[model samples]
Target chain A: MSTSEGTTSSVKVGGLTLEVHRRGAGKPLLLLAGEEQLELDAPFVAELARTHEVIIPSAPGFGHSERPDWITSPDDIAYMYLDLIDVLELRDVVVVGFALGGWIAAELATKTDRSISKLVLVDSYGVKLGSPTDRDILDIWTSRPEKVLAAKWADPAMGKRDFSKMNDDELTIIARNIESFARFCWEPYMHNPKLKQRLHRIKAPTLLIWGEKDGVISTSYGEGFAKLIPGARFAVVPGAAHYPQIEAPEAFLSTLRGFIG
Target chain B: MDAWHFTEMPYPNLPPIDSLSTMRVSLPNKLFDPKIGADLYNRYLDEYMIADDLGLNLLCNEHHQTATCIDVAAPLTAAILARQTSKGRICILGNPIANRGDPLRIAEEMAMIDCISHGRLDVGFVRGVPYEIFAANTNPTTTVERLWEGIDLVVKAWAPCDEPFNFEGRFTQRRAINLWPRPYQTPHPGIWITGSSDLENIKRAAGRGFVFATFLQPHEKVKWMFEGYRSAYRDTGLPGGGGTAYMPLVYTAETEEEAEKGAKELTWYLNAKAEPQYRNPPGYVPVDFNVNALKGTFTGRTDAMRAKTMEFLKEEGVMVYGTPDSVAKQIKRLYDLVGGFDHLLMMQQAGWLDHARTVKSMSLFAKEVYPQIRDLPRTKPLESRAAAE
Candidate 1:
């Protein structure tokens, strides 16, 4: 059991609640994110939130937040979160999403209100993977994460695990991540079958941050995002993967910090 | 012309801070931000990689559909941490065994991460949250059974013995299977369990001498859970004795106000973000409903008496808060209130708190509270091993 510095309950939205824990003060900079269970409260946003109120909401069905039954696609998560944007009545919100959430931000970017200050997508998907999508990403959850991420990491060191020893909760986290990953990366495989064509609809000034070594979506895909989104600028993070945020957070954030700010 | 317009904003550029606390990522609640998300994840990867420099344990987990939890939706999430922090543990308390067509597949993946991280791997298991059942189209009744059966198959697979391992159950069917290279650790790597009937899981873990952990609730509140497990040990139904683990989301800072400021958003944000998934038929507890119940959630079988009990518990330090020193005091008090805990896994960088705030909390605790408790049994340092080749 932990004491004072431990545990915070979920923040309520509608009848449901999403786990949000924040520190630092400033303009309400709403953050939409993707991946990783926040086990600790060591967020990298306080620097940014210090001058801005950072509002980071876990996508519905993640963390302490409820997974509404209506959400099934990146678009669904994006549109649903738009509710939060409205509810909080945040203005000039700097909407930033990574990976899956980046995909959602892109979807909503096309439809969100003028309150959006800027849109930054980090290694985002939800668009076509250039030519036709090649490798089937649907099998990722049940298959090897290395294989699932084989395309994302240039240095693929896929290791194996023996799940037999894990307790139910740990196993559940693994299972849920895989299922959710697949749910978002389904059909067109990370890239939306139509999201590429829809890029023209987005109005927010977009910044695309891609990891140089990202193997999942090729560097070519980043090119696609840059080319497709009106006035979208692209930057490559060195020594990173599909998850540049995890692999090269500084470069990723610097590139984004400059563009968003 | 939509109303959304882009404007130049001063996004906080707060630099990382120094500290020694458990290495874990703050899973923020924000689903949308001014900046794109891929950027944020990319940042997490880089920052988490620096955890090795901070001498902290790097961590992540799995949550599908829900926005707050994201790590390895699959076991491969370890690959990121494995490369970032060579010596720190790369844990995956995941792979809802019940939802899978074959749980052993996760075993294979975890084996891979374990190998990649060398011996520095801690594995925890969760039976998948209730809603995951609906999301995966799997039967909840069968998921739990599959979880146990799947566990049996995986552990047997990990054992050094080459003996044929057979597991045939309602959810999974596995025959003799062998995985090469196994895990880096002998007889597999470190194993942990989270959230189950406190008595049943803790006693079983104790007998195996494995790590036991739980989430939510303050330390004092967790005392009830530990007590249930201790009583299980007292029952002496098992041979060896008792074992329990506690993993709490803590925010420790220099001053009480700082810690509260560092951690307050989490309490408020959790309520804010969890609103979407609360509706599950009438009887289901609304997500926020628990806050009121938390004040009165315990011992409420009888309306009036339960209300009175909640009022009493709330006053009796049922939950705790404050500075590193204050936190130390609260933890010590709870330690005395309940049978002391073996280890404390702090997920301080969680919820929507900015990474800097979370790190500040760690810095404060490392400077103040941690030095005081460095000698705790759970805080011992294993000789730092070189990164696996």
Candidate 2:
């Protein structure tokens, strides 16, 4: 992944001071991150920045962002982002969310599409398509690391992290990410119970991008999710698992561009 | 010092350990034969009664979704012991209030137990184990906070109040809070807190004058926690002395061979397995603990502990067994090492250790080991001792 030059600074939203990375120029694109915070060096991030001014803010309790104790749910995160959208005063903005970020983006769109012109959810997690007893999401917290990795990426090696090779700061950030993800997703197990019912409230042109080989939450789940949203278009990038943007950036970008254009 | 006899009442008749990925969380309940469970429960209760007859205190604990501990409800077991055992304080160490739906329910149940035992009940509260987050459908990140809040609620509920008081906590809330039966012991029965790690929580427990307990931990680790407790207790100027307890596998017999055989059966408790996912739930422990684990410097439970040899366990004071004379010597050595604990919570029976063997071990421990350590002082804090010196 080629490193893209992006200025980093903290944006004060309500009580939260979030770390934001801004790159490129053109249309404003607010990128919501997933379990792990995405850096500017990510290939898909660079691709998005090429045609659009990408505004990526690390959600509260994630990366170096300041998280208030009261902000314990994904909806709390969505509300904070809503304030940021108004704070930045970015109108007709295109919002793209990945995984947990996708869930947040969908949540944001449901509440209001005031500034959001279009919404893109890449392997999003925010609706229950199965029965009460049916497990909608693979439990990453309790599963073995190897098992989770195998289910997370098309090639398991891509998702493998060697903590031994990382520095204290790096390791601490990883811990923070895991802790924050658990804080929000643990009780509901990564979906808002009311989100499925509220999908029609979104006014933004929506796209659901899925990885064909995504084992974390399968493409079939993505398809089921798309049917719930009003006129939400679903597309799959071939030969990619949960993280299509990282695994097959070209195909992912093509699918994303083809929709937003 | 007081000796408390205890057991996990583990059912160890399963297939070979190698065949199963885990012994907890996702283990099928169909594998558990209720016939054997009934026998184990009745036999375990009989052993506790035997301990009572032998003049030893009793301790029982609860764990969910695991074959290692069949006692899923500590209060129920404690309640039974309260009625059956005429002597010996029945200590349920303890209720997993953090995972429980209502802390008030625990307060009510414990109060009833205390009434049944007529003030001989020692109530213990615990932040449920890591794997319990899955079983209880609880968020791990919030449990420690929830535990403290739950304790506060339970404590407040037990206090004498003319009218019902409202409890509004972060994790739990109620319109009216008043406990029925209030507790036979004035205010409440003795409160005990147990966790092997979390030095901060240990200090807090001491500050609140709650008896702190650690089970099956290395003596060095226990010593660290005890030191923390002592310091906190001194700072608070608490009157009850540094109330602390240490539990280790304890088995004694006429011959070394018999004792060794009994000790081997106890090791089955240590061999209890859970998959990697259930071992450390995110936010269940301090971030530093996880960071240290990643850095390979974590001092918590390790794989080596499961496969611990007899000599290794004895050397570390994780287990104390053999003839009465030898067991007494080992206990004395451990006593000096960890300053001094008021209670010696002894796991005298576990795994497939039969009723006859359990009774024999309890009898030997009470007759031989308890008498030797009974007069030993619950050592004063180091500062107080130094001042006296």
Candidate 3:
């Protein structure tokens, strides 16, 4: 399917209806979004769909998805998405996740065997590489938006938003997204303390994608995350920070496609 | 009505207002001078003792990582007051149980306070303000749930169960749920949940037969909230409003002008201390309610109301400040407007109000204002209206 061919739909899994965006008609590739707004129609998603059927489901508590009260942690989301995969009857799927989504994907890989053929964690969070006192991820919640943007993007200009022009609906969507993000990631900061040990349980061939200029979580931390997973290849997309897929789409796609192919 | 003396025990000597946008959450600890804090704690305790001696119920509150309120732990303050004050009830309004990693510890601590106070403890549980979510590193989305769960666990722990039982809660879990030094009050000390415009919270308090105490909201808003509580209580088949309380900023002087002049100190508290960003972080208030629907809501109206003058505040019944007679009349009017309250949590010392002035105001209110309004008829619940007909 082409970029314009992508359609938004909903699927009921485990009594909760999840909004899923699907495109293309080849091998299944589940795209998990980060803490920010899930843009399934982004150029990167469309580009990926050209080769494979891209399935993007808004995580529970995000966008138009249903957030059951018990869905408060990434582990819970991992199970939910795992159930989504089973319900859809998708086999040999490639799981691609970004930021918090990446963290969820990592958790999913640990839980699934033979179901997910490959895993890609782009600037993911779910490991403790440093001492308890050391911060692996810059605290986006407490810091100023400009500071958060600076840490999140190689070119801070790309992260700029003219919030004044946003209508109440748009703003409410943004607020809801943030509240959902906080629900999942607030306590224990961004990383699960035990995920480092759990990384070894993942059987899928994994790729650790880090932005060269990623200041939010240092490349060193990415290296540490890669080291935890058995035989996981580490790659960096240059001229990008936390979101290389957005900041440097060509570089990110080249890295992603090279691994998944 | 029972009059309770309350203070945040604010660290009066603050750095330049420009240096910090807010006193809570992200405020640097280096700005906190332990030497000054030591002196302030002693002085604040002295004030509480004086209030106790004057036959006022002593109320203490807890906040984390904020110079705005230096009283970091309510149980500690309650324990201190329990030992010091003889007659006054030690009302800790309250322990922010949602932020506490272990809610059972609160049960243990409050139980200890009750034991120390010799049956004079009133446990008030609060969800705490928004910045506390940041300070305590708690999930804001789960605040209300955690608060209720914590309260349940605390109450259970305090109950006279001969055998240790298991408590499996979403926010808390313990295999052996038992508290040492059970409270002096049978079952437990009276549980009070602080109320705002949150209808669910008001209903929860009413259902649990806890005192629904509202603080600092405007008179009209308080009236609506009390009515909501009473209605909820009636839904639970209770008579009257169960127990209702209102906390208001109060100051009294020899004359009206002196009172107004002194009350101006609260403007610092209302405007400068609480920055909007810190006070109302995302997910602090539920997003289900449309933003437009909350335009004139109680908590939403605070910032605009904060900028108003003493006269405006007095007129709104957000505060009462004047001579003893005038203050008494204001209290009476507020009581009538809100139906009736079983208790009044009066904030006599706020902002940079000096200790001497606070003592003077407290003395005057106790001697003059207290007598005039203490016997005023309590407001009947909306159920009373149905019964009257």
Best by DockQ: 2
C-alpha lDDT score of every prediction, in listed order: 0.56, 0.87, 0.83
Model 2 root-mean-square deviation: 2.0
- Provide DockQ values for all models, in the order shown: 0.01, 0.81, 0.38
Off by over 4 Å in 3: A1-5, A160-173, B239-241, B272-277, B289-302, B384-389
lDDT of each residue in B1-389, candidate 2, tens digit only:
99999998787878888898888898888889999889888988888888899999999999889988889999999999999989899998888888996999999999999999999999898898888889898888888888899998888899999999887778887987777879999868899998777888988998888999998778888888888888878877784434989988999999999899999998887878888888888877877777887787874474658767888999898999999999999999999988888999998887788888889889988898889999989856558634322
Candidate 3 C-alpha lDDT tens digits along A1-261: 112567888899889999888888799999898877544546888788778999988889776788998887899999999899989999999999999999999999988787999999999998878888888888777777677788988899988766666566655656677778888888788988778889999899999999998989989989989999999999988889998998889999999989898
lDDT of 3: 0.83
Order of all candidates by lDDT, from best down to worst?
A: 2, 3, 1
Q: Write out the backbone clash pairs for model 3.
A: B339-B379, B340-B379
State the lDDT of candidate 2 residue by residue for A7-91, as single tens digits: 8888999977998889989899999888876534677777777789999888898878887779888889999998999899989
**Where does the lowest 10-residue lDDT sum fall in candidate 3 chain B?**
B289-298
In lDDT terms, how accurate is model 2? 0.87
| C-alpha RMSD in Å of predicted model 3 compared with the true structure | 3.0
Candidate 1 shows a clash count of 165
Could you tell which candidate, 1 or 2, scores higher by TM-score?
A: 2
What range of 10 consecutive residues in model 1 chain B has the weakest lDDT sum?
Answer: B1-10
TM-score of each: 0.47, 0.97, 0.93
Query: Compared to the true structure, candidate 1 yields what TM-score?
Result: 0.47
